[model samples]
Target: MNDFVTVAVFDYPHEITVLKHLLDQAEIDYFFENETMMNIAPMYSQALGGIRLKVHPEDAETVREILKKLNDESNLKIV
Candidate 1:
């Protein structure tokens, strides 16, 4: 929702869920727009047409930094 900012971006359902789970584990509140199985068909998304994970605009930088740090620690890159 607009209440949260767009902190980072993910490729598809997996990334969306992963980021959401991370935020949940950290107790950071977030909002998401999932049109995959809703309006826009995932089959047509071409791997990039899926859910969208959003965070509070104010928390955007914070969430991104945290995600980056997590990715760095695990040698993983968050989309």
Candidate 2:
């Protein structure tokens, strides 16, 4: 069984896209919950707690570090 953990939550599609790209580049496996739901009805994103990025528990720390580095380099924040 894969133990996944939420690393971040984003309300915007573009933000999720960017983070997915970073995770891909670093070869970190991840999945986003509520992405389809958010796409279907953006207004519900807030109520649904936004889109959640999940990763293996073992990769959670690495994912966070990568996100932080990307944010720092781009002067953008992903939460």
Question: Per model, how many backbone clashes are there?
Answer: 5, 0
Please list all clashing residue pairs in model 2, or write none if there are none: none
- Residues 1-79, candidate 2: write the lDDT tens digits: 1588888888867777777777888888889999999989999988999999999999989998886787785675545
Candidate 2 Cα outliers beyond 4 Å, as residue runs: 73-79
RMSD of 1: 3.8
TM-score, candidate number 1: 0.61
**Per-residue alpha-carbon lDDT of model 1 for 1-79, expressed as tens digits?**
6566555555455566566677888787776565455345656444653456577677777787877777786666655
List the lowest-lDDT window of 10 residues for candidate 1: 37-46
Structural similarity to truth (TM-score) of each candidate: 0.61, 0.84
Q: Report lDDT (CA) for all predictions.
A: 0.63, 0.83
